[model samples]
Target: MKCLPSSLLILAVFPLVVVAKRRRVPFMNCPSTKSSSGLGMVKQARSRIECSVICLNNPECLSASYCKSSDGYTCQLSQMFLAGGCSGLPANGDCTQTFVVYPCENGGTFFHENRTCHCVDGFIGDYCHRRYRDCQETPLGNVLYTIQPFRSDYTFQWKCGPFTSPYTRVSEYASVFNFNYTLTWEQMKQGITPHPGFYFTGPETLHQLTKQGVYDLFIRMIVLGKNSGYVIYKHFRVDSEAEGYACHWKSFTRYYEVPYNSDEYLDGLGALGDSTKSMKGARFGTFDNDVSECAGTHNFAWWYNPLGCTLVTFDPDGLNWPTNRTGTVEIEKIDHTLIGLRNVYWYVEDDLIL
Candidate 1:
C-alpha cells in the first residue's frame, strides 16, 4: 500500500474522534437527591399533579419528573421561570420559594423575592408581561420578502456578543427609535437607464474607489445597476450602564441594514451623512418591481466586530464570541481589537450615500 499524506490521514481519523467525543448522558446516572426509601423518589411521572407535589416538597426542585411509568420519580432542582403550561396546579401556590428576580438586561441579577424588576409602572398584567419578540423580520438585501406569515412565524435568536453593542443609552434618544423602516423593491422608485451623469455613475464610481469584497461588491453593483436600499431598524435596550466619576459612559445600539438606495435621493445622488443620521436631502425611495430583482440581499449582521464599541465585552474569554462563524473573520487578540469606537461606522454611512 502506498503511504498516505499527513492531511489525508488526519481527515480519516477526525470523524472517528468527533463521534467519540459526542456528549452522552448516562441512562441511569444523575445527581443524588435525598430519598424516603433510601433509593430516592425514582418513579414514573404519571401526572402534572404528581410532578407538582414532588416539586413542592423538595426545596431544591424547580420541577419534577417520573423516571419511568412503572415506579420512580426524580426532581430536577431550583429556579422559578415563568410558570405556565401546567394545567392542574394552582398558579399562585406553584412557585413560593423566596429568591431574587431580574430583567433580561439586568446582568442576570437578583435583588429579593420578585423585587429586582418593577413592572415599569402603568403596566398591568400577570408578571407585568410585555410581549417577547425576536428581531424584526424585515426584508434584507434587495430581496422583496413579505412580513413573516400569520399563525406560524419562525423562531430566531440574537446572539449578540460584545461587538454588536450600541453607542447611546436608550433613555437618551427615544425618538431615534423611528429609524426602523422597511421596503419592498416595490417600495423603491422606478427608473430607466438614462445617459450617464455623476449620479448615474455611483456604482461604477464606487467600484473604481473601493476594492471588491462582499459589502463593497454590493455597493458597486447597486450603485451601478439598480440603487441603494435600507434595512429595517434594529434597537438595543440599555442592558446595563454606570456613570463613572471620571465622566465615562458606555452603551450599545443594534440594527439590521439592508442595501438601500435611491435614484432621486435627497441630495440628488450626493453623499450620505453620518451612519446614524441621513443627509438633509436624502429622501426614502421605492421600486415597483420585487426587491429580489435588485442587487443586495438583506441579511443579519452583528453590530461592530470583536471590538465591542457598543457592547463592550470587558473580557472576551468570558463571553466566548470571538469569531463571526460566517462572512466575517475574527481579529486576533482583544488588544489587537479595532477602535474609533463610533467614528468609523458614522463615516461608513457618510461614504455610502448615493
Candidate 2:
C-alpha cells in the first residue's frame, strides 16, 4: 500500500487540549459534607464569629450558617473561583477542597478544584484533560487486578497500560487470547492477523511491534460496581523501529477518550466516590466502531466522549469481580493488497462481563 506520507504524518499530532464541561459544576464552600447544588445548602452563618469555621478554615466558603443548638457551624461553598480565589478579591487563602483522595501515577495526589478532580502530571482541567496523552487518569477500581507485562520485539514506555492479565490472539486484527507458552510462531503467524485489544500511542508514523514474536499484554481500567467490566484497549506490534518510521509515532500516549453518552459503555459512577468500584457505575463506552477496529478503526481514543457511553465495570477492587463479563468481537477476512495475502481478519476486540 502507500508507505505513510512524510511531513503530513508529523502534523497529525499537536499539543494536547483540555476544556471544562459539566452539568452545573457541583462546587461547595461549606463543610456540611453534602454535595453543593448551587442552592442554599448551609444554613448561613448565624453570627459573624462562627463564620470562621466555614470561612477562615476554608476560603472557598463564600456563605455559611450556625446550628445554634448543635454548637456547630456549616459553610456554604462558593463557586470555586480560579483555583484560589476570584479576581481582585482580597483572597482569603487556599480554599482547595480535600475529598476522595487517590494516588496519581508518579508520586502525588490527583488535583481537585471547583469540584472536578484529575491527575497531577502537569494536567489541569476537567477530568485531567489538559496534559500529554500519557497524562490522562487511569481509574483502577476495587478489583485489585495484579498482572505483569511482556513485550514482543519492540516496546516503549508510554505505550504500556496497567495489564491485570496477559493475552494473545490470531485474526486480521488479532482477537483471541493465546496467552504464553501455549502457541508457537507458526501458530501465531497463521493464527490471527491483528489481535484485539490493540491500542497505540499518538505518533505520525505507524509503529509495528519491533519484535515479531509471541507477546502477551496485561491491561487494566477502572470499572465500577460488582459485575461491571471496562473495555481493554491495548496496542500490539508496537515498539518497532520501522513501524515508528511508518506510523511516525514517537511520543506514545493514551487517554481515556471514553464515551459517556452511550447505553453500552457508560460511566456508571455517580460522579464522586471513595473507592474505585465506588466510582458509582461510571460508564466507559459503547462497543461501537469508535471502540472497535475491524469495523473501521476510527481513532476514538479519548475517554468521556460526548457521544460515547460508560458503565459500571467489573470492580477491580477486592470486594467484587465481574463473574459474568464476556468479550465480543468481529472476525472478517480481507485481501491485504500490499502483502498479496487474502486472509480472514478480525478487528475491534473487546471483553465484556455481564
TM per candidate = 0.17, 0.19
Model 1 residue 343 distance off true place after TM-score fit, in angstroms: 25
Q: What is the lDDT of residue 95 in candidate 1?
A: 25
CA RMSD of all predictions: 23.7, 23.0
C-alpha lDDT of residue 125 in model 2: 26
Model 2 gets an lDDT of 0.24
- lDDT, candidate 1, at 166: 30
The model with the greatest lDDT is 2
User: Model 1, which residues run further than 4 Å from truth?
Assistant: 1-51, 56-152, 155-285, 289-354
State the lDDT of candidate 1 residue by residue for 1-354, as single tens digits. Answer: 111111110001101112211221111111233111112244334443443444434433333333332234343323333232233332222222211112222122222233222333222112222211211212122222221111223321222113333311010111112221223332212211221111121111112112111111111112224333311111111111121000111222222245533222221011122233221211221222212221112111111211112221222121111222244433212221111111111112101000
